[model samples]
Target: MARRATVYQVAERAGVSIATVSYTFRQPQRVRPETRELVLQAARALGYVPSGNARGLAKGRSQVLGLYAFDMFLPCDLSAPEVGLDDLVAQELDRLGDVRRFPLYVDEIQRGFELEARRLGRSVMLGSGTSRDSLGSIDLAGSVDGLAIFPGGAARDLLEHVGRGVPVVIFSSPPMHDPLHHITVANESAVRELVDHLVEQHGHRSLAFLGELAAPDIGARFTGFQGALAAHGLPVPEEPFDSTVLTEDSLRTLRAAIASGDVPDALVCATDQLALTVVDLLARHGLRVPEDVAVTGFDGIIAGRLSDPTLTTVRQPFVSMGRLAVRILTDTARGLAHPTSYVLPTRLVIGRSCGCS
Candidate 1:
């Protein structure tokens, strides 16, 4: 292999001082445009790339933002550092069909985050971790000027800890009483509107909420389901069905429900991931969506549009949510704004899967 070109070589070739080479890349506005162009031209000729780390250290800024997702787990082999890049965008391409573990929500949001970061001359590092291990989140914190986190489990505590030293934004969690910056969606109202459509328009007597209650977002949505039932004067189940995805046990339980004629007229799922998988599960048992039973999901992922009967669901502003988080962090980093929390909105999407024409 050939030897890598050094800054000294670039500085010598550019007919500029070493300091000029550094300023040209790190603070081009401080240098003459022609000088910056000369250094860039020399860099291209020598195939030399300046080190982002060194430049960051010089300017007391990393110029990179961190996005640490909570409640994500990986297989043993995938946890190894040498195995793969810790980026959500690259991983999302092949996960569309893996409904239980599909990466649509985070991928869409990350696309917006990444695009804004690029536009602002910042780099982004994406990471996923569970509460049991925090080394990944910490390592990311050490490298970023600001960080965005998904709220859950011990992550709230971590968010606070990181916020003490740098700007932090947490998204998709329960509303916090504290003043820490956060981003949330109108989960309850959105689901309530969805269920309202099922009862008021379709005259469905039996509507069951389907999802695990451990997640705060699901809990909020289930509350909406209960509220809608109460408004219609219908009997509401004491709890949700406790199954969302198509796992073996969940499938077995659902199959038994069908066998015993206990199936509801509609299933209000907490997420598109669960609803899409349940659609497939119902088909295996010869149940037709919106005919034999209706189904609705939250989070308007793209795959919902392609389902046999296009999914009726609520669409969260995922891209805007992401873009807003980055804006908050970048603004805070530059002293342009103070950290604040926000509740984003969602809209109900009309589609055939919910028994609507």
Candidate 2:
């Protein structure tokens, strides 16, 4: 049997000390570039991969960052010897039916996070949890030096609990867990600005916000919707789409509103995904976008660009937020005082959906 290549072998082959080999992987910036290259070249030759457990035991740190998410990661159920067709069909449906589930905000944030982790000479581990398991986060927290988590209300307690032990960064949620760091954009102000544009320039009178306030960032957008309506002397809705989350019930209400042919002058969605849903619903009911009901979304995801009207919306710096989270986690883990929470900026993008073309 072949032996697993050890760091000592790489160190010997590179003609460097063991510490230099460790620093080359754990903290590459501290090593001279030529020396780092030599070590890496030796490692490649010997198929030598640094051991996170060994590194942690010796240096008190794992050179791996975790990106934990809330049930967003799903793969074919391969626990069995072979996944049956029925299981595969259900898995694909489960992946597709989930709106904004993947290849959107979360994917964009992960791309940024991975990029930053690589920049810092660290590897990233993606951990995902379903609603059924609260312990998923606990197990992941134990394995990584730092973690960047996607926000979900169900994981609030777990997030706070993990923050106490590890350098944790929360993304796209409120700063309710003050002890933990956050990488969020200007949710309220960006929505406020987007809404103000609709009211002032497009002259949208009866504007309705199309998402629930259960999510903190979505709630912030709703607040901006109310603020803009009040500023325009328009009636503010006490509840949004039955004051519920994005579930079947709210969608039913949206369908009924469209069916009755009494929809608002404009629909300001909490997310680009919701805006796409609205666009589809309106089309199903024979309503034209902008010409009949103007629509706008908040997140500047790629889908919004290809939507029939090319959605007008606020673009959050998803990638930048990701990069910033890694910085916060790595810095905080280094015995530096906890970093301050960050609020990155957003931009209002004018597109055809809002009649801006």
- Assess candidate 2 and give its lDDT: 0.82
User: Per-residue CA lDDT of candidate 1, range 51-136, in tens?
Assistant: 87787788788899999877643232244355355565466566556544444788788888998898898999888777767777
In candidate 1, how many Å is residue 275 off? Answer: 0.8
Off by over 4 Å in 1: 1-20, 27-47, 72-103, 152-154, 244-246
TM agreement with the true structure for every prediction: 0.83, 0.80
For candidate 1, the clash count comes to 0
Tens digits of lDDT, candidate 2, 221-253: 888778877887999888785353444444777
